[model samples]
Target: MGAFSFLSRVLHTKPSNYSKILVLVSVSSGGLIAYAESHSNNETKIVEQSQPEPKRKRVVVLGTGWASISFLQDLDVSSYDVQVVSPRNYFAFTPLLPSVTCGTVEARSIVEPIRNILKKGNGKIHFWEAECLKIDAKEKKLHCRSNIDENLVGNNDFSLDYDYLIVAVGARVNTFNTPGVLEYCHFLKEVEDAQRIRRSVIDCFEKAVLPGLSEEERRTNLHFVIVGGGPTGIEFAAELHDFVHEDLVRIYPEVKDLAKITVIQSGDHILNTFDERISTFAERKFQRDGIEVLTGCRVVSVTDEFINMKVKATGENVKVPHGMVVWSTGVGTRPVVTDFMEQIGQTNRRALATDEWLRVKGCEGVYALGDCATVDQRKIMEDITSIFKAADKDNSGTLTVDEFEDVIEDIIISYPQVELYVKSKHLLEVVDLLRDYEGNKQGEIDIEGFKLALSHVDSQTKSLPATAQVAAQQGAYLSRCFNRWEQCKRNPEGPRHFKGSGRHEFRPFSYRHLGQFAPLGGDQAAAELPGDWVSMGRSTQWLWYSVYASKQVSWRTRILVVADWTRRYIFGRDSSRI
Candidate 1:
């Protein structure tokens, strides 16, 4: 009846109370209609008690990271009922996580609420702050659990259903099963994990300064050992180095030079994933800050007060005592993904097998995207030109968008992303859109006068990423897709093809890799910017700051980061933690 009523209904309050007033609206309208004030569609009819029909196809997407968010942004929202399920309601830009841990940037700057992104609801995409426990492919239902504290509230579990599903659950950091690792090693994967680490680092410095402690105990507590020389581990070690020099020495001179930070990586270099130049530069910087670079080292165990490591070069074991140890290795699949794959029995080589269209093999209404899916996209080789000829029934060669969508949808349902034809991208959009189309209950679609409408079938979460760019990109992509899907549904026969209306129109998703850059202290930094190997100092530091500043998510956030930097220049990085 009004905004208040919609709000009440959405909040699950007294919705009926507000809806009762709707009866009066029709009587008033009927009086106008009788006075020759009739609208074009209904010359004399009075409308009453009508609700917008809920779209039939429910599409559930997992994860709030780069892939899921991107898919949400780009999907046609008007055509289907869309829902996003994830642990965190906000999309965290992961690249800046290390800075947050070191107090260089506030944690809130890198996070954007999921609701804010979905406010432009083209097809009514909803948000669910929970983790998907399991998937029943046969029933098309998801078992989910809220990440919030349910014991405090006494209620939390729920289940959701979907007609089409996209699993974008990403990977988690892997620790290689090191002994005592789960018990003693802190991980820098999440914000809370970082804050806990920051406090622990500060606490250790103070304890080392206590007079009653023996030299061995003090050294053991003051030592900061970071295992894994990956980007996460290196950034953390560098930040700790700055905190000690910039704040620790001045605050507690008694323990000056007492704090030790070590980075142990298994490879010959750190950040092996990046250009060699970036890796070398990172090493020189680490050495300059008095942080140890123990390359070619393997961690054997993590104890309450020391880390047991092995020098791979010599096969000699080494023990480094420490108050806190952080493990920042790369990532691997999570339980939800593995178990679901096994249950489906369609997964091979530890990944979901999908054709070029991203459809799961041996399944219908199930799709896969992002890191969870290992789609080659090169396997598709259907002669799309033939599709033009195929849809040309009686050789007319004229195609309609509505007819095209039906043709392409039917074709893609049988074929996951496997053909060289999928490279056209427009074809991919057609296929992805078909994933949620609800009209074809028989799963058999035919476009009249279309030559290539007949087709065969094909097909295809874990967590959010550590980088914000990936998270944001995914958010934007998914949103766009939903928006377009909605638009297509409104005009089923419009220029947008539903089934080989002879038009090759569809949006394709593309990923642009941005090189890695993180802020290091005092005219020093490291960049893995799309090139060769070798460390650059002094010259690239300014460029590094520029990169970080430009990627602050928004102008307001950039301003906050700039202000924080300026204050740090004048006051130094704050080491005081109470």
Candidate 2:
């Protein structure tokens, strides 16, 4: 065993102080191999320390979203001074946000206090309820303001200096520069936003029931419009349909037929990112539910009581009156991230660019994840020559089948796109790509031929979608990297290089897609699992319930969510406007 390991085992103390002693003792260099014992009055003690302990690195994390929370939960805080800052003090389960809008699940049941999450981990992680305003990349400082003290203080602003900064603040709602969207539309990006939407939904029904309104006015007042037919918009429309038919119609029996829900999609179909079968099924279900789906149409503007759109197929201008509008199109970068990008010379980019290792390009000791950043996956074509040269060990101009086989694993590890390309082509192995069209299994190829064979691999490169699953996985991967940072620095642990000599210090981040769920309401759902498995219907809805309940951050939350679902089933969703 190494001296540090020996000292750590003998001490049996907390890792914070234990790591400090290991740093002070020159343990890895053999200075603390022997522990001298001193005796007095029949008592024994270890040798006295001759040097002071070095300070740990300060790691500042911004945001309490899925990414940041995952990082904190998995990180070993014994070696670093970790501090978390965000406007909210809780981590919300955002997948159930549509349910919250219709009271299927209470908002509080879906959120876990950041403090509670931290307490379950190492007690060293600290949190602050504040917002990050600016990032000084050159100086490694952050300008922040307290969210709670903004109303009482002269200036709630403060600064933080960090050795390493983690940017996971997530993105903001994108209005797409559409006119009047900011002033008239409600968004469903947060818990508070869902609560506001619920209140507005109740207000719409109450106003339509008022005696002063005519039949035309009542119809206009009861119309609900949702812009953007993505997963969020589709799910919201389904939930609203269920809410109205299952509950609201019974309460307001006079204007039962007046309620109308419409979904506007710029794309040809709702849930375009999902499987085509799933998308078709959703459209059919919505059609059967009397929900109007306007496909291939873009919203030009939204007013207080009207939304204007242009039909793509016929170039027809369409105008519709609505009581309320919910905007769930896409996400945009925050001001702080935009400013940081400019500081680091990343201009005209929608999101921050990061290396495959999750490190921000052109910056040192800083990393970004979640919706605010996109990984710039390296292309295989960029290093084709180096790879070919490295594989040709005998200085031969042509590479044989054996030589190609030896380096194929390394190539797949270093560049994931190669594996994806092989899968896309329905090939069993990467070596199959080396074969000719005549089904030649064994052959020798020159550099030019090798380049031609792999040229199309780069076309398979695609960006990861900004989702909670991606962010959570990224956080866990980064925490593992940080936990083993010192060990990996001393001895590289990643796969051997296909372009160079020595192995890489760490493996690049790769996303593992377990599966995704689309709840279609009315005891029905759809799921796209790994290995091209697609499932739909009531059984899938039960699976969705089990999966979401199990994925909660805490058992308290898991139980609460399950209880809320049970309560909603036993006694329909609480329709109180509160």
Candidate 3:
């Protein structure tokens, strides 16, 4: 019969006057298979059109920070029901937070609404503007409270049940229990904090220019003391210097020379986390810019008028007057995270601990990313016995050179430290680690020999830095794992199993360092790229601008940031308090 005749027979009627006709055709070994359907405006009924859909697991994400936002952006939400809860509904590009502090970039230009991010996908994702008060890991529930309007209703608190929870709420500024520090020092952690610092900077200049102010008083008021000479503090000092000499000095020339910027660091050098060359360059640049960098000094007490410090080298106390103090020391755990940590028996740990896969060790179905967690790498010595057994495929008590070579790839993939160890020791090959003390390379090795070879490998295990780069990479890694959760369950794709028979369901999380950048004042910057490459100077400053503009979460923010930078260059930073 003809194709039209077969289609008419399948439909059980002529296809004439049909409003819609659906045909699905597939070629099989026997013959062509076709599915035909006809719909009439009058009385046609679809044959069993409705089918049940598999229930999707609920994934509750906490925070709108780098890790959480990156996770949401990459996650396959069609596979899981996702809901985000955060006190702030917008994601801020935190790396540029220092720029925000001095109006080098506006705060609004660095933030994007969470809802706007979700609108890019077809999946329906819910967001609640609330803070997670408590996480009940035992019951898999969350207690959240909305701070929007607490007085309008009864109990602004609610509970949510989740199959999986992602904790990415970032850390709070650390004050280190210093007296009067929290009350007087300004922080640069959030957008609001930056705005506050900006207004304060203007206020310091305004008060200095007031009539009847003595030179000493004017100097004191114009003094800007920054605590903790980390990246945030250094950048702020640089930005403030530019704002002073470039813009503010032109407006208030009387107190311009009196304006002084001092950086107090407990460490021996500013940007100690950076390369020594970069740190030296930063210090020298600051000195040339007339920014005083006081190293080997610790701030013990900070008052409104005086900042008390004890010199680590001299053990002598010194008091310095300041108009404003900005604290960019470091991050500490949040209260909610602290409570959650206590519940999970992570009392001694500063940040939540996760296995190599990013799964919380004590709690099931819970994961952590960002500065709020650290990956606890398994020591090779702990698994040395199982590794030996796995390599001994012939049920022998020893491993030959061929046996060891067979599993070398899996070993490297499973424990990255093995490769690092070999490279650091300057060995020709990783297999050389198995050589006996007397120098026998191509020989059989017992369990003792295997243990000895890998015993020092654990020393190469280092925790990843808590940088935005690390957090973003971790978020992407976890999203890929979640996307393939079901597929990997049936067919494990991890490295070869050393403990048992089959491979792990998914590969462990691995971090690849991209690079880091530090912007010094005077249109100069420094970058530490991969492979120990360092670049600095005006060219690096342009690189910094390009990298920062490109790293914006949305093109709207990107354009806004670039516009802000251009506006600053053409008109100078907006020194108005507003």
Leading candidate by lDDT: 2
Q: Pick the candidate with the highest TM-score.
A: 2
Candidate 1 positional error at 249, Å: 1.4
Q: How many residue pairs clash in each candidate?
A: 99, 0, 0
Question: Tens digits of per-residue lDDT for model 3 on 1-578?
Answer: 47657666756765577656666443334344445454634444444233346799899999999899889999888888999999998999988888887888998999999999989666478999999999999999999999787668677789999998999998888898999988999998889999999999999989998999899999999999999988888988888888889898888988878999999999999999899999999999999989999999999999989999999999999999999999888888898889989998899777899988788889989999998999988777887887888889998898998889888777887888887888789888767877888877847889887887788888999888778899899899888888878545542124437545555557777788788998998899999998789999999999999999999889999999999999999989887887
lDDT of 3 at 514: 85
- The TM-score of predicted model 1 comes to 0.71
Q: Over the full model, what C-alpha lDDT does candidate 3 score relative to the true structure?
A: 0.86
In angstroms, how far off is 111's CA in candidate 3?
Answer: 0.6
**Which of candidates 1 and 3 reaches a greater TM-score?**
3
Cα deviation at 124, candidate 3, in Å, is 1.3
Q: Candidate 2 — what's its lDDT?
A: 0.87
Candidate 3 residue pairs in clash (backbone atoms < 3 Å): none
- Provide the lDDT at 212 for model 3: 93
What lDDT tens digits, residue by residue, belong to model 1 across residues 156-233? 778999987888787666777778988998887666777788778888887888889887787788888888887678
lDDT of each: 0.65, 0.87, 0.86
- Greater lDDT among 1 and 3 belongs to 3
Worst lDDT window (10 residues) for model 1?
455-464
Please list the residue runs of candidate 1 whose C-alpha ends up more than 4 Å from where it truly belongs after superposition: 1-56, 74-76, 151-154, 346-363, 369-373, 379-510, 518-520, 530-535, 554-556
